[model samples]
Target: MLIYNMWPMWVIVVAVFLYLSIKSYKERNAKDVIILMTVVIIFSFLTVRSVNWLYGWNIF
Candidate 1:
């Protein structure tokens, strides 16, 4: 239910990631690109887990 309710956030996150990724890659910096991906993955994981915990559900 929370996931459904927060669809906008998911979309925003994806969009930001794509935009940043492209821009970062254009600079040809391997380290920056890798760090960006790692941060996004960790951020998404924490967001879903935190939402689930706060709402007291197992939808995630």
Candidate 2:
């Protein structure tokens, strides 16, 4: 149930990030792609952390 809450947001974020990454790649916007990927990685990691906390899983 907790994962249910986190998963949707994660999916949306990843989807949008992927879309942007592809778009940037096609446009040859290296800087944009790099920034977008960085943001995606950071957000994904935070999402994982939040999920672990919610599920009482210590991932240290």
Candidate 3:
């Protein structure tokens, strides 16, 4: 599966967002959650681009 090789990166991205969202929830920080999500989105985009480049997927 194409996803098999890319699972690790996706897992790490999801894990980071999960951790931040939980922490923000516990602390009741709306701004932090928003910022965290924005950062995570950018990180995910970069990761996908890097993965595409690495694997010559041409998806981007």
| Number of the top lDDT candidate | 2
Q: Which one is best on TM-score?
A: 2
lDDT of 1 by residue, 1-60 (tens): 455456458657856886787789999988888877876786677667766776677977
Better of 2 and 3 by lDDT: 2
lDDT score of model 2? Answer: 0.81
CA lDDT of each prediction against the hidden true structure: 0.72, 0.81, 0.76
**Number of clashes recorded per candidate:** 0, 0, 0
Where model 2 places Cα greater than 4 Å from the true spot, the runs are 1-7
Model 1 CA lDDT for position 25: 94
What does candidate 2's lDDT look like per residue over 1-60, in tens digits?
A: 565467558868977997999899999999999999988887787777777777788884
RMSD of each: 4.7, 3.4, 5.3
Give the per-residue Cα lDDT of candidate 2 at 25. Answer: 95
In model 3, where do residues sit more than 4 Å from their true spots? 1-14
TM-scores across all candidates?
A: 0.56, 0.71, 0.63
Per-residue error for 47 in candidate 2, Å, reads 0.7
